[model samples]
Target chain A: MIHLQNVEKVYQTKTIETVALNNINLEVGKSEFVSVMGPSGCGKSTMLNIMGLLDLPSDGKVMIDGQTFEAYSDKALAQFRNQTLGFIFQSYHLINDLSVIDNVELPLLYRNVNRKERKRLASEALEKVGLGNRMKHFPTQLSGGQKQRVAIARAIVGKPKIILADEPTGNLDSVMGNEVMDILLKLNEIDDTTIVMVTHDETMARKTHRLVRLFDGTQVN
Target chain B: MIRHLFLIIWNQKRRNFGLILEIFFSFLVLFAVLTFIIDKYNYYRQPLGFEYQNVWSIYQDTKGAPKEEVFATQEQIRNALKSFPEIIDFTFTNSNIPYGSSRSITSLKKGDKEIDADIFTVDEHFASTLGMSLSEGRWFNESDRAAGYKPVIINGVFKEEAFGDEPAAGQMVEDYNDNPLKIIGVVDQYKYRGEFVKPFAGFFQRVDTTFAVRSLLLHVRSNADAKFEERLNKRLDQIASNWSFEINYLDEMRKSTLRETKIPMLIFIIISAFLVFNVALGLFGVLWYNINKRKQEIGIRRAMGASKSGIGRQFVGEVLVISTLSLALGTFFAVQFPLLKVFSVQAGVYFLSIVVSAILIYLIAFTCSLYPSVQAAKLQPAVALHDE
Candidate 1:
C-alpha cells in the first residue's frame, strides 16, 4: 500500500518557480496494478519518482504500508527502498560492464545477501523473465526488448513489495512492448505484486486495474 | 565487498591499465628512494672508530723535496713539537686521514693468496694519536723499528677475510713481492672514506725509511682556540723552513664528509616527493573522470538501495584494489634487487623499503579517491537518472 498526502514539488531558480507536482493526494492498494498517464512536462515522472522515494516531495507526508517516512534518515530510506520498492526505467539501465546475472544481483548485493544465495536468487529471477539462457551475456550484446527483460529481472530480484515502471516500453516496438506488458500483467496476477506504471499510451493505460490522469501537475480523472 | 571491488576492476582492466602502470612506476621509484635513505641512515648510526674532536690534519706539502730531505725534515719537526703542551700527540701518515681526499691501495700476499688492501704508513704512536682501539696484540713500539719482519696492524675485515677465525697475531702476511710482515694487532673498524663507503680490508705499517708521508695529524688539547692554528703554524715554520703546509680541523672535515651526502640526499627526497605528488594528481584525475562517466551507474546503485557510504566505499575500494595489483607487479621487480644482491645494499633495508612503499601507494590511492568518491555519493539519484 502507498499513500501521498498534500504532496507538492516546486523547482525554484533565481528567476522562476516551476510547480512539478502540487497539492496532490493519492493511494494505491495492495496487489493493485495502476497506470498514470500524462503528456510531456505534466509531472507523471515526478509523481513516480516521489512514490519511488527517489526524490522527496517538497511539502507532504509519504506513507507506505501505514508507516510514514518523515523520520527516516537517508540511510533508512535507502534500506527501505532496497527492501520494499523496485524500479524499471525506459533505458533498462543495466550496468554495461556486468553480466546479465550480475546486474540482477546488484540489489541483493546492497542487502548483504550471501554470495551463494545471491547467485541462486539472481538466476531464479533471470529465469522468471526468460533470460536464464542469457545470464552471462552483457547488456551491450542484447536486443532492446531483451535488455528490458533483464531490467525486469533485476527489478524483481529482491522480491520487493511494489514495482514502479516509468515509461518501460518507450524505447521498444509494439511487439516487444506487448511482450513486456504481458510479463508485468502476469507478475501482478500471479505473484500479486503491487504495480505502478507511468505511460503516454491510452491503450496501455486501459489495461491496468485503474487509470489516473494528470494535467499541469494536478489529477484530472 | 572487497572481492566485488576486485571483480569490477578486473572487468574494466583495459580502461584501468594505464592507471596500474602509473602506480607501478611510482611504487618502484619510491622503493629505490626509501632503500637508499634507510641504508644511509643505518650506516650513519655506526661509530666512525676514531675521535675527530679537537684533531687537525696538516698536509705536509713537500713541494718536490728529495726523499732523504723529506725524511730528515719530518724527523726534525716531530722532535721540535714534542714538548708543546698544546699539542697532545702528533703522528705521520702517507695521505690517509679520517676524511682525506686521496687513497692508497696495494696487495699483500700470503702463500698463493693475494689480498688487495688499503695501506697506511704511520709511526708507533699513530693508534693512540687517533684514539683507535685494537682487539689483539700491541701497537708498534721501538722493538718493531729494528724490523727483521715488519710489524703491521690489520683491521678486523681484512683479518677475517685473509685468515678466517684464525689467530692473526704473530702470523706473517707479505708484501706483493713476498717480503714477510707480521700482523701485530687487529682494529675493528676504520671507515676513513665516509659513512657511505663500507669498511674495507686494510693494513697499517710503520713509516720507517720511506719519505712518502704527506700528512701530519695532531690531537690538540681540548679548549685550544683559534690561536691554536697560529701557534701550530709558527711551530711548523721554526722546524722545517721549506715545509709548505695547510691545517684543517678533522671534525670539520668529518662533518663535510656527511654534508656531501646530505645535499644530494635532500635533493633526491624533494624530487621523489614531487614525483609522488604528480602521480597522486594523475590518480585523482583518472578517478574523477571515471566517476563522472559512471554517473548513471552510480544513480542506479543508489536507487536500488546503496547507501551513500556504500558508493564511496566502492570507489575507494576499487582504487585500493588497483593499487594492490600495481604493488604486486612493482614488488616483483623490487625484490630482485635485494635477492640478487644487485646494488650491494643491506637485505633489511630492501625489505623495509618494500613494506613502506606498499603502504605509501595504498595511502596515495585512498586519499586521491576520497574527494571524487564523495562527489559521486552526493549525486541525487532522481536528477542523475533523469539526465539520460
Candidate 2:
C-alpha cells in the first residue's frame, strides 16, 4: 500500500548540510504491518514523516496506493491525507482544551461530516478503543495510556486505509504499551488496515509482520 | 463550524475570561465615544435658522439705573446705530440673546395642551437685524400693539410641539399667567443656544414699550471692523455718558461657543483613542502568546488534514468569536442608555453607535489576529509535532 524508491531527505542550513534519509527503497503491501527501528539521529522519524507525506523528500518518488502525488497542491495533499492516511504521535497530541470526544472527532471535522454524524462516528471509535466511558473527560484528565487510546480513536475515526504511528506506545508503561499494541494488532487483523510504525522497542517491532532497521541515514536490513 | 469554535472557546472560558472582559470594556468605551461624536455631528449639521455674521450684541449695563433712563439709553443707542452707514439695522431686546448664558423659560398653554418654552422679547426690527425669515404670517409691528392680545411668534419646533400638523399662525395660546398670547407668525427653526445644542420649543414675544431693554443687536455691513467698533463705542459714550457698553461680535461669540463644546469632545476623543490602542496591543500580545502555546495543537490539526489557510481561519475565527461574545454583552448594556433615557440623545444615535463600535472592535480583533495566525499557519507540521 506504500511505495518509496531511492527517497533521499536532506536538512540544510546556511552553513551546514545534513542528510536525513539516504537512498532508501522500501515497500509494504496491502494490509501489511511494518515497523521501522533505529537509534537516535538515525533518520527513523524523518523516513516516517516522508512516507506519511508530512515532510517532502529531497530527492526520489513517493507513491501511495499506486498513484504519485508530486504535482498535488497543498490543499490537494491535505485532502489526500484526510481521505487516505491517519497519524498517531508519541505524545498522543490531544488538544487539552477539547474533550475526549471532540479530540476523536477532529479528523472527521476536515471532511464533509455533519455534527451529528461526526459525534456518532467518534463515539463508535471511542467505544472500539475502550474509551467510551471517558469521552466526556479532557485529555488533561486522562492517563497516558487513555490519552494514547484517544489518539488511536482519532486516528481510526476517519477509517483511513493506512495508519502512520510514530512511537504510539513510547510514553506508556509496559502493560499499557501491550494493550495499545493489541489494539493496533486487532485493527490490522480484523479491519485489514495497513500500518507503518516507527518504534525503538525490539519486542514491539518483532510483533509486526516485518522489521526494517536504519543506521546513520541508511537502511541496514 | 461556528458551534465547534464556540465550544472550544467555552471550554477554555477560564483562560479567555480576561480577554472577554477587555474586549467588553473596549466596546463600551467605543460606544460611548462614538455616540457623543455622532450626536454632536447630527446637531452640528442642522441649520441654526438665523445669521450671525457681521452682527454684534451690545450689553447696555445701566447699573440699576431708573427704568425710564434705561429705556431712553437703549433708544439713543438704536438711533445712533441707525446713523452709521456701516450699521444695517439694530433692535432692542432683553438679556435673552442667542449663545448668552441668560434664559427666560415659561409654560405656554393651548386648550389644556401645555408645553415649556423659552421666551425671547424683541422689537419689530429684531427679525430684520438677525436675518430671520418667517415661515408663515408677519413679524411684529406697531399694529400688533393695538390688538386685543399680545403678539407672539413661535418657531416651527414649538409649533409642532403645541399644534402638531395644524397651522400655527393666528392661533392663540395662553402664557403662565393665563394671559392670551396671539401667535402672529411661525419661524421654521431658531436654534438660539448654539450649533451643538438641540432646538427647544420657544417663541418670540413683542417687547413692551415700558420694559427696560438691556441688550441691543446690530446688523452691520460686511466691512465693519475694529475701527467701526471703536467709532460705535465713541458714539455710545457720546449718547449715554453714564451707561457702560459691552460690545461682542456675534461671529466671535459663535466661535467661542463652538470651542466650548468642542474642547471637551476633543479631549474625550484623545482619551478614547489611547484606550483603543492599548486594547489593540493587548489583543495582539495575547494572540501571539496563544499561538506559541498551541503550536502542538496546530501541528496536530495540520497532520489531521487542515490546510494552512484552514489553520489561519481557525485562529482568526476564534478571535472573531470572542469579539462577538463581548460585543453581544456590550450591546446589552449600551441599549440601556436609550431605553432608560440616560442621555437626552435620540435613540437612533445610540443604535448607530452600537453598530459602529461593533465594527471597530471586529476590525481590531481581525487586525491583531492576522499576523500571529499567519505565523502559526506557517509552522512545519513535523517540527511543530516535536515542540514541547
Candidate 3:
C-alpha cells in the first residue's frame, strides 16, 4: 500500500525554483494496478520517484504501508526501498558485464543472500520470465525485449511488495511493448502484485484498473 | 568478503596488474639491496675473533728521530706509554692489522701444499694487546722471537692444514722468499677484513722482528669518543716527529658502507609510501568510476530491496578483493627473484628480506582500501536511481 498527501516537489538551481509536482494526492491499495499519466514537465516521473523513495518531496508525507520516511536512517531507507519495491525501466539497466543470472542476482547479493541460494532464486526468477535458458547470456547478447524481460525477472527475484514501472515500454516498439505489458498484466492478475506504472500514453493509462493524470503539476483524477 | 575483494582484482587483472608488479619489484629490489648490505655487514664483523670495542688503535708517525731525541730507545718509548694513566695496554705492530686496508699477503708453502697467509710483524706484547686467544698451541713468548729464536706463530688454518694439530710449534713453512721458519705457536683463526663474516684464514705474527713498526695499537678502556683521539694525538705528538700521517678510526678505515645506497634506500622508501598512497587513490578512483558506470544497475538493486550497505559492501568488497590479489601476485613475483638466487644467496639474507617486504605489502594494500570502502558503502539509492 502507498499513499501521498498533497505532495509538493521543487527543483532549484542558483537563480530559480521550478515546481515539479504541486498539491498531489494519490493512493494505491494492496494488489491494485494504477497507471499515472502526464505530459512532459507534468511531474509523473517525479511523482513516481517520490513514491519509490528514490527522491524526497519538498513538502509531503509519503506513507509506504503506514510509515512516514522523514526519520528513517539512510541505511534503513535503502533497505526498506530495496525490499519493498521492484523497479522496471525503459532502458532495462542490465549490467553489461554480468550474465543474465548475475544481473538477476544483484538484488539478492545486496541482501547478502548466500551465493548458491541466490543462484537458485535468480534462475527460478529468470524461468518465471521465460529466460531460464538464457541465464548465462550477457545483456549484449539479448534482444531489446529479452533484456527488458531480464530486468523484469531481476525485479521479481527479491519478491518486493510493490512493482514500480517508470516508462517501462518507452524504448520498445508497439508489438514488444504490448508483449511486455502482457507480462506485467499477468503478474498483476495472477500474482496479485501491487503495481504503480508511470507513462505518457493515454491508451496505456486506460488499460490499467485506475488512472491519475497530472497537468502543470496538479493531479486530475 | 576477502574472497570478493580477490574476485574484484581477478576481474580487472589487465588494467591493474602492471602497476602492481612495478610496486612489487620496486619494494623487492629495495629489500634485496638492504639485505645484501646487512648480510655483508654481519659477515664483516664475523672474523673479528676478539671484540674491538673498548679498544682503540693509535697511529704513531715515528719518523727518523734525532740522535738527541728525548725518547730515542724502544725502552724509553715503551716506559713513557706504560706511565700514561689513560692507557690500558699498548703494543707496536706492522701496518697489516686485522681489518686494515694496507694488506701485505704472501703465500706460504709446506711440502706440496701452498697456503696464503697474511704475514704480520709485531712486538713481544702484540698478542696480548690484540687479546688473541690460542685455540691449540701457546702464542709466541719472548724466547720464540726471530731476533733470539727461529720460531713463528701460525694461525689455526695453517696448523689445521700443515700439522693437523700435531704441535705446529716445531713445523717449518716457507714464506714468499722461501725463507724457512719454524712455527712456534698455532693460534686460532679470526677475521681479517671488515665486520663482515668470511671464510677460514690464517695470520702469522713474527714476534722477534727488530724492524721499526709504523702502527701502534692501544686498547683503552673508554668508548670510541672524540676525547680519546685528542689524548692519542697528544701522546703521538710527544713520540712522533716531522712526518705527519693521517690518523683514522677503525670504522672509517673500513669504508664498508656507501652514500649511494642511502640515496637509493631513502628514495625507495619514499617511493614505497607513494606507491601505497597512489594505490589507495587508484582504488578509490576505480570504485567511484564503477559506481558511476552502474547507476542504473544500482537503482534496480535498490528497487529490489537491496540495502544501501549491501550495495556499498558490494563495491568496497570488490575493491578490497582486488587489492589482496594484487599483493599476492606481487609477493609471488617478488619472492621468486630472491628465491632463484638461493644457491648464490645466504639463507638468512633472503629469508629476512622476503619477510620484511611481505609485511610492507600487506600493510600497503590494507591501508589503501579504507577510504574507498567507506565511500562505496555510502551509495544513495535515490541518486543512483536517477543516474544515467
Candidate 4:
C-alpha cells in the first residue's frame, strides 16, 4: 500500500523555477497493480521516484505500509528500501562488469545473508525469470530481452513487498514486451506482489488493475 | 565485502593494468630511496671511534730530499711542535689519515681464516693525539721494539672478523709474508673512510719515531685559532725551509667528506620526489576517470540498497586492492636484495624499506581516491540513473 498527500516537486535554478509535480494525491491498495501514463516531461517519473524514496518531494507527506518516513535517516531509509522495495529501470541498468548471477545478487549483498544463501536465492530468482541458463553471461553478451529478464530477477531477488518499475519494457520489442509484462502479471497474481509501473504505451497501461494519467504537472484523473 | 571488491577488481584487470604498473614502479623507487637514506642514517649515528675536533693534519712534502736530511728536518719539526704550548699532543704517522682519500690494504691470516684489512702505520703517541680509547689492552710503547713479534693494535671489527668471540690481545696472526703480527690491543671502532661507508677491518702497526713519517696529527687547545696556524706554518718553514706543508683542520675535512657523501643522495631524493608526485597525479586522474565511467553502476548499486558511505567505501576499497596487488609484486622483488646479498647493507635495512614503501604507496592510493569517491557518493541516485 502507498499514499501521497499534496506531493509537489519543483526544479529551481538561479533565474527560473519549473514545477515537476503539483498538488498530487494518490493511493494504491495492497497487492494492486497500477500504471501511470504520461507524455515526455509530464512528471510521471518524478512521482515514481518520490514513491520509491529515491528523491524527496518539495512539499508533501509519503506513507508506505502505514508508516510515515519523514524522520528516517539516509542509512535507515536505505535499509528500509532494501527490506521493502525493489526497482527496475528502463535501460536494464545491470552492471556490465558483473555476470548475470552477480547482478541479481546485488540487492541481497546489503542484507545479512551469507554468500551461499545469497547464491541460492539469486539462482532461484533467475530461474523464476527464465534466466537460469544465462547466469554466467554478462550484460553486454545478452540480448535486450534477456537483459530485461535479468533485471527483473534482480528486482525480485530480495522478495520485496513493493516493486517500482520505471518503463520496464520501454526498450523491448512487442514480443519481448509481452513476455516481460506476463512475468510481471504472474508475480502480481501468484506471489501477491504490489507493482507500480510508468509507461507511454496505452496497451501496457490498460493491462494494470488501475490507470492514472498526468498532464503538465497535475493528475488528470 | 573484501571478496566482492576483489572480484570486481579482478574482472576489470585489463582496465587497471596501467595503474597497477605505475604503482609497482613507484613502490620500487620508494624502496630504493628509503634504503639509501636509512643505510646512510644508520652509518651517520655510529661513533667514529677517533675524535677529530681541535685537530689538524699537516702533510709534509720533502721534495725528494736525502733520507738523512729529511729525517733531521722531521726531528726539527717535532721539536718545534713540542715547543708550542697551544699544541696538546702530536703524532707522526704515514699518509693514511682519517677522512683522507689514501688507503693501504693488506690481508691477515690465521690458519684457513684470512681477512683483508686496512693497515695504518703510526708512532706511539697516535692514540693519545686522536683521543682513541682501547677496548682491551694497552697501546704500543718503546718496549715493543725489543719484542720478538711485530706489535699491532686491531680495531673491534677486525677482531670480530679475524678472532670471533675470543680475546684478540696477545693473539698472533700472520701477515701476507708469513711474518707474525701480535694483536697487542683492540680499539672499539675506527671508520676512517667517513661516516657514509661501511666499516672495514683495520689495524695499526707501530713505528719507533718521526724518522719515516710524512703526516703529523696535532691535538691543539680549543683556543688555537687561524692566527696560531699562521704562526705554526711560519715556524715549520723555518724548521724545514725546503719542505712544503699542507695544513687542514680535521673538522673541516669531516664536513667536506659528509658533503661528498650527501650530494648524490640529495639529487636522488629530488628525482624520487618528482617521480612520486607525477605518479600521484596519474593515480588521481585514473580514479577520477573511473568514477565518471562507472556512474551508472553507482546509481544501480544505490538503488539496490547501498548507502552513500557504502559506495564511498567500495571505491576506496577497490583502489586499496589494486595497490595491494602491486605492492605484493614489488615486495617479492625487494626481498631478493637481502636474500641474494646484492649490497653490503644489513638485511634489516631492506626489510624496513619494504615496509615503509608499502605504507607510502597505500597512503598515496588512499589520498588519491578520496575526493573522487566522495563525489561518486554524493551523486543522487535518480539523477545518476538518468545521466546516461
Whole-model lDDT per candidate: 0.89, 0.92, 0.71, 0.92
The local distance difference test score of model 4 is 0.92
The list of candidate 2 runs beyond 4 A from truth reads none
Lowest lDDT block of 10, candidate 2 chain A: A65-74
lDDT of 1 by residue, A1-221 (tens): 99989999999999999999988899999999999998899999999999988898999888887778889888998999999999999999989988899999999999999999999999999999998899999999999999999999999999998999998888999999988999999999998999999998777778899998888999887
**Superposition error at A82 for model 2 (Å):** 0.9
* TM accuracy, model 1: 0.94
User: Which sections of candidate 4 miss by over 4 Å?
Assistant: B208-211
Quote the positional error of residue B256 for candidate 1 in Å: 3.0
What's the lDDT for residue A84 in model 2?
Answer: 89
lDDT of candidate 3 over A1-221, digit per residue (tens)? 99999899998999999999999888899999999888887988888889988888999789997778988987788778768878888788887766789889877766778989999999999988889899989899999989989999988888887898988888888888887888888889988889999887777777789998889899987
For candidate 3, give the lDDT of residue B248.
Answer: 56
lDDT of 4 by residue, B1-388 (tens): 8888998999899999999999999999999999999999998888899889999999999998877887788888888898999999999898989998899999999878998999899989999999999999999998998988899999988999988899999999999999998889999888888888888899999865444778999999999988999999999999888889999989999999999879989998999999999999999999999999999998888888988999999999999999999999999999999999999999999999999999999999999999999999998888878877
TM-score of each: 0.94, 0.98, 0.76, 0.98
For candidate 4, give fnat to 2 decimals: 0.60
Worst 10 residues of 3 chain B by lDDT: B253-262
Restricted to chain B, the TM-score per model reads 0.93, 0.97, 0.65, 0.97
Candidate 4's displacement at residue A178, Å, is: 1.2
- Candidate 3 residue-wise lDDT, B10-129, digit = tens: 545786666466555545654666566556656655555554544556555546754345235445667767876666777777786755666777788888888877677776676777
